[model samples]
Target chain A: MSPEKVQGGLEPSETVAIVGASLAGGACITRLRELGFTGRIQAIDCDPFAPYDRPPLSKRFLAQNTEIETPRWWSPDCEVIRARAVAFDAQRRALRLRDTSGAERNISADAVVIATGAQPRRLPIEPDGVFALRTAGDALALRHAVDAGAKHVAVIGAGVLGTEIASSLRQQDLQVSMVDAASLPLVRLLGRGMGARAIDWMKEWNVDLHLGVRIESIRCDHGVCAVTLGSGVAIESDLIISAVGARPAVDWLINSGLAIRDGVLCDASGSALSMGHNVVPRVYVAGDVASVECPNGSFARDESWTGAKQQGVKVAETMYYGAQQTVQPEPPYFWTEQFGRRVQILGRVSENGAVSCVKSVPDRNGGLFKVAESGAHVAWIAINAPSLFAQVKAGLLP
Target chain B: MKVALDAKRCQGHARCAAFAPETFVFDDEGFSRVREGFENVKPELQEKVRRACTNCPEGAITISG
Candidate 1:
């Protein structure tokens, strides 16, 4: 559909209520305004601060000792509501929200966007020294704890966020130890060989690696945490950062009657999919909270920064025009910075897929690896070689 | 209209090239660059090009007459 066709049927006076005013929510409202949707836009987020970029939380914001300034994204024209969306009444097209002051109200809208992102998964045991990074405030608090003489740090989980946090803490001259249930860090995404290579980098950075172990219990005393692993080893550290994973923040939608599995179930076009294979009209899902079913009958949730933003744009277009006008699905792209190297991956890299080095750089620990399934190229991984990644990406295009 | 890409702000998201491959191409470093001789998009393809600019998460693309 053409840009003008986006606003074809919708009236400018229509109200669009968006929950979770983070990256995805911000992108949706911005795209709507840019497309000449002169409707009343209400952005509701539990965060008291305005919408800001999140990528910095794990990197620059965590390492820096000084105050880190948040970069705002919402425009002044949008109404920013600092409140928690408690429930959604789809039949009435209304949302129940509770403000920080403990006041509750119901606001009706012509359409609703469920951009409520994911929250960090907590361990079975809750202790004072355990922390998870998901927001600007979390980063600030972690940094403060480190600055206040947190010498030994133990990071649970070896995923992108966990490893990145370990790298940042190591940069701050703290002793770092990493524990993960997986055999190797990122093995599920990068495959075994590449994951092993990443482990080598972690070891070189002096991070104590405790793989294939689960934290049985955590005991905190006098601001120090003693994490006991399944192997019966107790690691004493001043702070514990749990980068285990995240679950879609869909507790509020439990009674809302939305079909949720892993996340809010949606079709490829970002329209909420009900249990009976019917579209939940006037309600859209995006960001980490959305699990989109692909044409291949598989469901995938892209929690990356780029994925959330693209999903936001698609959801906006679908809401404005129709699902028939949805943009074409692009290959999944993800990047992470850890151990002073930038790792980029395009396409899906299955655990059992065969991988081969497509290109290499001299004297640099970087190369392009092509992952294939039964001789068909399915994904590409580039380590510290952005130029090669660009070349491979161009070759993937038709 | 002339389409320009702000390379400094791009963090290799590559949405521009993903959406409008004919008009935008990624350089060696994975950053976006307008395809050769396609700096000024044709009137017929302007809408598609505009979608690419609109979808960029970094807001690094600009279209001008």
Candidate 2:
């Protein structure tokens, strides 16, 4: 690659400011350098610690928080600001931040990257005992609750995150009950046939799964937490996990005025869309904050760990390195582990219709599964049969 | 003919694509995609491909007419 893009002699060419030094932002910075973005590369985070992993936070870390205190950090040379990006000025190509010390700093950049990951969405009732798992602090807090003899843990939401959290709670020897609004667990991701199989696996683990139901509120009853479902049913528990889903962390970008859609609206190249009227220069976005529209006319707002990492790296390469490669929205891919069953899906599932399992072979607590033609297979989901998913992944002709 | 996944109408059913991997791919959020060789999915594979589309729960995948 070309020599790292440099700005000045003593000072670099142009300062690069990355908001949210977590997964996407950090990946971009490192990749920018790899793609020869040698100018002063900077990354900012509100947390005192540097950037780390997320999958583990929900899986291994939750089970053994005592062993892994926080997600691992980056190399010593990579720049990190233990601060929060508070605002973006697309006009001036600058960013406003409040560091860990409570001091605000204004940093200007030739370009900006918004990778302000997501936060655990909470319910309004102020559930006295329920919590959501997203950040390191959240994981640590949940660990404390589990160790403190919290019995009858009720995890709300039956998606991957909620399932793993409940399974971990059960591993801690706490009775776990999983609640979701879907007819079967993972109905949205794995389809009905595979979903039933997943429920069967959870059953083996003895999880009290309340499928097709949602918990309306979490309140304490006689010193223990009572989770109330919409059906006027209360499930007694010492812990409750609220994991519906995560929204874009765009509170800071409210007035940034760069065309915010479900996530940040981005071009095929991951460049931020502009209404620049000459006052603002072009800005680009990737990761969770970016929703990329492929040249093929398809679009995706990907938020998985793999999606963010690869997209971040690609954005850096295309913009800085002269690859000039346009990003295509690939099919969705994510995996979840619950009660010894590894469920992975390669494609989308429609909400408006039916799901018929194409082929079935007995495998895990469930078996290998492929979610049929939802809308995209380049993005498909597979569980315990990546070998079969591999056939589809290669675009292999039948 | 172009390929498209009508995401709004999708439900995860792996029918149209599974039998004919050469013709379709059912991925993320119940979205189906037209495979490469867009020019030619062998006549033998057409039945499997069409069957997948017919069995699709949401009828989301539609190849250009």
Candidate 3:
């Protein structure tokens, strides 16, 4: 039987402190209001310009310097505060916040949603012409470098971000050379075959690839940048972009007693867990910062945009209706645009799953390949096949 | 209820259609557009339409009654 609901679900007058006002935090606020929550909401975030779309940062925004629009749901009712979360007091349901002026304050709430998200992992070497894209500011800075006539760009890391940046740079007619320690692009994330396909596509787009090598040094002298590989191969460029992935922004929660492995550990219902693995009541986690419990008892962070939004909604539901009524998560999905093609990944794509079929959509000039196991669709990868993807995804996901 | 989609803001995530196909449709290039008749939404479709609005990653959809 389903466990009893927490006696006295959240009242309309209760206050909820959401620490992070980006995609996940914004979504949580939207859902709370949709559920008729009239409570006081404190949307805390370090970014003065929070709640903006992030996917375009490396794509259209970096290439054409497109405007990163703020979410429509970011209304005045949420009471957004421009502050960085410094610490959490789980027992008291309180938070310590530091604003831009270094002023510190504490606020207690009936519930707290930790959605601090993640930050780009910086490289060991620091140089003037090097950059990493994560926020709107980062993208603008990178675009400024491009506009200032930085022709050749050396991208370090062949993961999704790296490849996407390379594609965007190529769209702007800038020469791009990519380096990754892995043998192919997205090797760890998408497996070997998909990685090979990505590398091939990048090559087709005229992006120089230096794979299966370690970076010995990245030096920027005066104006020119140089990247030296472990294989004695060296690449010269005017700029360097380190797309080395990101880590959860969980430093502030270190002393909060929350479980912190790769991210803040949370139960299936989005309730955060203490280091001893006990649920911390009224304390929740969402977005890239939440490492939610899985079937095998392992905690994993859903870092994708869709996953983050879903978690945000779930967290809101749990906060309003109580954890007993929290909905199970939907399938994982993410999309990317590169080399004039839109690629979408639905569900899980594993190399172990056999490739069931590859079909082409003649009308859209697109194609999709499916991965299945035991007559069930494990995942589907679609390239410029949104309609087909929609049908398959609709049928597969609830 | 009326739903409006900012064409400039829609990056073709196609989530609106996925959530409420009756209220939203996609263009040839996969960008989302509010279904023509959806300007005045039927009472029964309001919940789903609002769901689509809330779930949109780009927050391109807005609803007014």
Best by lDDT: 3
Model 1 ranges with Cα > 4 A deviation? A1-9, A64-75, A396-398, B1-65
Q: List DockQ for all candidates.
A: 0.30, 0.02, 0.41
Q: In model 2, which regions exceed 4 Å deviation?
A: A1-12, A65-76, A220-223, A275-282, A294-299, A321-323, A327-331, A351-363, A374-381, A386-397, B1-65
Candidate 1 per-residue C-alpha lDDT over A13-38 given as tens digits, one digit per residue, 9 for 90 to 100: 78999998888888888778766789
Best by TM-score: 3
Query: Per-residue lDDT of A259-292 in model 2, one digit per residue for the tens?
Result: 6767777766666765542212336676877777
The residue-level lDDT of candidate 3 at A8 comes to 43
Rank by DockQ, highest first: 3, 1, 2
* Global lDDT scores for all candidate models: 0.82, 0.64, 0.83
Candidate 1 matches the true fold with a TM-score of: 0.88
Candidate 2 lDDT: 0.64
Pick the DockQ winner: 3
What is candidate 3's lDDT per residue for A277-315, written digit by digit as tens? 999988889999999999898889888988888888888
**Chain A alone, TM-score per model:** 0.94, 0.85, 0.93
